[model samples]
Target: MKIGVLALQGAFYEHRKMIEQLGAECIEIRQLSDLTSNRFDGLMLPGGESTVQGKLLAELGITEPLRNLINAGTPVLATCAGLILLAEEIEGGEKPYLGTLPVAVKRNAFGRQLGSFEYTGSVGDLKDFKMTFIRAPIITAGHSDEVQTTAVFEDKIVAVKYRNQIGLAFHPELDQDTRIHEEFLELCKSFSLNK
Candidate 1:
């Protein structure tokens, strides 16, 4: 399967490495032309500055197209700032970006970079998953019924899934564990076959 990792900002290369390590083709999506040249089976939006990524997505003319892909059933795995991008509503009045996932998010819910920490807990069906948070954002409690929360930290929601989109407040790519990547690829493969 071919996976596209948005390279406009953030820890995109790490996601690329994980995708390749999991035996899938990885494509770095840096421009609109890149999407035209590739029919990505899946996508990865890595952690970074949400503001900068949102700006770049607009300036690069990729915002709508990418959102269309996600909405059209192209599975996406969005992490941290990426999670903020996909959120339908962002708390504190930050304008939503893609709005493909049916959820609300709170940016930097765990403070700033210094507030970052690691947690090993259940993510979806993956038991004992290692979650690395860096300037993370949390999926707020009140969201649409379509959103199925998959992971939580303390008493706060950290991850959720809606349709073909998987949004996480932690950086699964930063950790050494391959379970999340493996699961994503399987999801992509399943989607590909059905298409």
Candidate 2:
């Protein structure tokens, strides 16, 4: 399976490495041509400056195309700042991008860089899931019933599955555990066959 990773900016390399380790072709999507030329089974949005990524996406003419793909039921794994892009709203009134996932996110709710932490908690069905947070955003609220809350940190929603899109407030790709990526790749496999 081939996965297209948004490489405009962020921890995209980390995501790419994880995808490769899982036996998938990882394509770095830096421009509109990258998206148009690729036949990827899934999309990965890694943690980074959400505002900058959003600006570059629009400037590079990739916002609409990427959104369309996600809206068309393409499997996507969005983490940290990536989660901010997909949310329907930004909790503090910052702009929203993509807006494919029906949840509101509070950017850097866990604090700045010095506030980052690693925790072992339940993520979806993985009870002992370990996740890393780096200036992560928290899903404050869900705007649709389709948004199924999967994992919570400190009683706040950290992960959710909305249809084919999976949003996470923590960096699963940053860890050695491949469970989350494996699950997403399985979704991609199913989607590839069905599509």
Candidate 3:
């Protein structure tokens, strides 16, 4: 199966490598043309600065198409800033988001870039994953009761998965372990067969 990673900014290349490691063809999506022409079973939006990523995505005219695809039940794995873009509302950001998930996010919730951290945790479907967080945005709230909090930090949710969508406030792609990617591959496989 083919998986597309948003390569506009941030650790997109890292995500591409991880996805490729999962035995799936990887597509680096930088332009709207890529989104239109590519046939992907799943997509990953890597961690980055949400405000900048949002504006950059707008400039590329991919925000809407991505939102549409996810709404149509396309398998999506979003990390950090990518998670922020998927939220329905951001606590304090003027930039528009893709609004694919029913959650509220607080940008830089983990504090500044210097306040970044590396923690060992069980990321639900993928256990014992060492997650790296750099200026991460935490999911402050989820409107739907169906939203399942997958991982937590000090009792605060850091990762969640609902249906075909998964969001993480940490960088799973940055880790050497391919379990996260493999789990996403399973999500892709299920989504593809069911769709």
lDDT of 1 by residue, 1-195 (tens): 999999998999999998998899999999999987899899999999989999999999999999889988999999998999999899988789998887889988989889989999999899999999988898875467878989999989999988899999999888789898898898999999998
Candidate 2, residues 10-48, lDDT tens digits: the string is: 999999999899899999999999999988899999999
Per-candidate total of colliding backbone pairs: 0, 0, 0
TM for every model, in the order presented, reads 0.98, 0.98, 0.96
Better of 2 and 3 by lDDT: 2
Off by over 4 Å in 2: none
lDDT of each: 0.91, 0.93, 0.88
TM-score sort, best first? 2, 1, 3
lDDT of 2: 0.93
RMSD of each: 0.9, 0.8, 1.2
Model 3 clashing residue pairs (backbone): none
Runs of candidate 3 with Cα error greater than 4 angstroms are 93-95
**For model 1, what is the C-alpha lDDT against the true structure?**
0.91
For lDDT, the strongest prediction is 2
Deviation in Å, model 3, residue 61 alpha carbon: 1.5
